[model samples]
Target chain A: MAPLIGVVEFPGTNCERDVAHVLEILGGRAEILWHGESSVKGADAIVIPGGFAHGDYLRAGAIARFSPVMTAVAEFARGGGPVLGICNGFQVLTEAGLLPGALHKNSGLRFLCQEVALEVVGTDNIIGSRLEPGRVLHIPINHFEGSYVCSHDTLRNITESGQIVLRYVDNPNGSVGSIAAVANIEGNVVGMMPHPERASDVLLGSTDGIDVLGSLIDCLAGDTEPTPVDQGH
Target chain B: MRFDVKVEVRPRAGIADPEGATVGKALRALGFEGVGDSTTVHVGKLIEFDLEAPDVPTARDRVDAMCHTLLTNPVIEDYSFEVIPADSGSGD
Candidate 1:
């Protein structure tokens, strides 16, 4: 049976379907889960795609973090289920305290809408585990507030724990340590500023996202685990 | 009793505030007196509302809770608020 992947959609989220389309193309059953819905509908894995949830009113992902669906999502994540957050979804996870660090306005003070070069630094997370270390990926990042910031203590912790999943090759958005993605200690919940779904088709540009989403499917099928092999960064 | 509550939210001390830096630079370029080259300027938020509470402490406590939860992101921002009785004719 194909793995059932739940794509969560908050009110202002615009990338749910795009993420779902990519997952479906990768041989997983994609289901759209509304933010209002409290349950994940028995999904084997969950995804929070990017967009301005709750119109980013109080702050990006501030109000959306309180939505009922997030409660269920947190519960699923606590059980070690795989969860991925992209762009604005990453903001929500931080506001909800599911992930560490907060994303602030880009230092350039302008919205960036371009593809960036990323290097896989640590394979501690499910997505990074699927790809080889030091591999370069081209992903699109479209956001005004994509700069990542955290306390120095948190930075040291993430570095020592190997929770950093990805880093920018050129540090476009001022993310600390040039980090582009991160995961928890267990490597089950991961968040990234880039939009992997937007890189699905070769006609559009790149298809590097297939491997990222495919890794989630493999984890759901119990075909993969947290491999502690050092990437020797 | 009604209380007029005003809340101010700003980026934390060490957080990088590019918006603030940009405004400070613009002010310096415009030759504003007393606005030095290194003067710090920050753009923050102000929220005001009318609340019904029995006493000053009650109103203050309510607004404080709001600041801790919704009005500020503790990870990057800090907040302060003041509560004044609405009927004193100093609602500003």
Candidate 2:
């Protein structure tokens, strides 16, 4: 059976359609779920696409945390369902408390839009399960508030538990430990500042993201071993 | 009554503060030795308040509520305020 992936859409979620299109291209039945919805039933996996959820007012993801759809996302994640948050969606996840830490203004204090090289640091969760530890891939990141911040003890625990998913090679946003992404303790929930959906196509200057997204799909299907390209860093 | 509110927000630890560092360097160039030691902190809005409530205590409560609910992000920011009697510091 084709995997059913839910693409959640908030009011200003600009990447929902692009992510949905990519999932469809990858052989998943991608459904658009509105922010007012309350469940991710029938979904093998779910995605929170990137965008300025609420005009970034009063803080980037602050307002979107109260959306009805997030209530369902939280529930879905708690159930061990595979959930991925990209860019702005990543911010939303932290604000919703589904993920620890927070995304603060970029250190440069500029809205950066560029391709970044990321190294997969941990592979215990669904998102990282398909990728070998230490594998480097290029993904585009466009955000002003992409830096990851957390307490020292919390960072140590996440790192020791293999919850740290991705780290930027150049520390584009001044994230702690160059942390570009992380998953929950269970690994079912992942949030990343880079836009994997944007780089899923080869014509878009890189097909590197395809393998990452494909690995995510494979994980949802219960696969655990890292793919060939993902082997050896 | 007049109220003075100061909100100080800084990048959390491990987060870079290039803006603050840059200003510190500039201050040194300008020969302001003490200012050179200042780390970059983004402080915003020195808000002055004039309340219409019946009493100072009542007005203070309203302003405090406003600060919590809208004036600042409680999770990332810390605020301090001085609620001074309208004529306490200045002779009428």
Candidate 3:
């Protein structure tokens, strides 16, 4: 059966349709779930695409964290469901505490819009399984607060545990060690600053993001590869 | 009442925060290299205030409330304030 992927949409969120469209192109039936919804009833996986939820009034994702939909996403992730967060969605994940660290403003204090090169570092998660370490992929990023920061010890642990799935090649946000993406301890959830959904098709620019999303489809299809965690330094 | 308020802002981690790093480099260039060991130096604005209130505690409480609701982004920033008596216009 084709995977039923749900995309959550908040009031200020603008990327829901784009993500949903991408999922359809990738052979999955994508549905947009309103933020007030309580459950992922028919979702095999979920994607929280990028957007300025809540006008970024309270530290980007802070306000959106309290939305009713998050509770459902949290529960879904806890149940071993695959979840992916891109850009603002990444911010929301951190705000919801589904993932660690927070996405803060760009160090330059400017809203950045450009394609970034990311190096895959962890593959245990569904998003990482399709790409090899050192492989460079290009994805567009449009955000003011995209920095990923955490305590030194937590950063160390994330690195040691192979949870740092993506790293910006140019260190765009001054994130600790250019960490662009990370997965939860269970590897079922991932939050990344680059927008993979935006680049799934060649007409959009780069198809590198397809590999990342394709991994999700593979995961839903029960392509159970024992992608063991790598303690990459 | 006199209240002391400070606004602290730091760059989010792993961002190519050129502004913060530039400032750090500027500090080192100015011979304050000891500041290195640090990439970002948080910037803050201190707002001291004197408010006429029934009591010092009341003034402090009001000021603290103002800070959270208006003075800073509580999600990304933390703040603290102290209240003291404001001296009358000293023209001596």
Clashes of each: 0, 2, 13
Identify the candidate with maximal lDDT: 1
- Tell me the deviation in Å of residue A196 in model 3: 0.9
Q: Which structure among the candidates has the greatest DockQ?
A: 1
- For residues A1-233, could you state the per-residue lDDT of candidate 3 as single tens digits? 57788998988999999888767777777899888998986798989888888897747777887789889999988888999998988988888888888776677777889999998899999787678998999998888888777777788988899899999999876677899999998899999988887777778898887788878877876733333221111
Give the clashing residue pairs of candidate 2, or none. A135-A233, B20-B40
Instruction: Identify the CAPRI category of the predicted complex in candidate 1.
Output: high
User: Candidate 1, what DockQ?
Assistant: 0.84
For the second chain, the TM-scores of the candidates in order are 0.90, 0.61, 0.63
Q: Judging by TM-score against the true structure, name the best candidate.
A: 1
Query: Each prediction's TM-score against the native?
Result: 0.94, 0.80, 0.75
> Which lDDT value does model 1 have at B5?
92
Local error of candidate 3 at A231, Å? 30
A10-46, model 2: which lDDT tens digit per residue?
8888999988877777666689988888777577888
- Relative to the true structure, candidate 3 reaches a TM of 0.75
In DockQ, how does model 2 score against the reference complex? 0.27
Comparing 1 and 3 on DockQ, the stronger one? 1
lDDT of 1 by residue, A1-233 (tens): 67788999989999999999888777677999999998999998899999989999989999998999999999999999888999998999888888999999998899999999899877878786478888999988999988899999999999999988889999887888998899988999999999988887887687777667767766766643432221110
RMSD of 1: 4.2
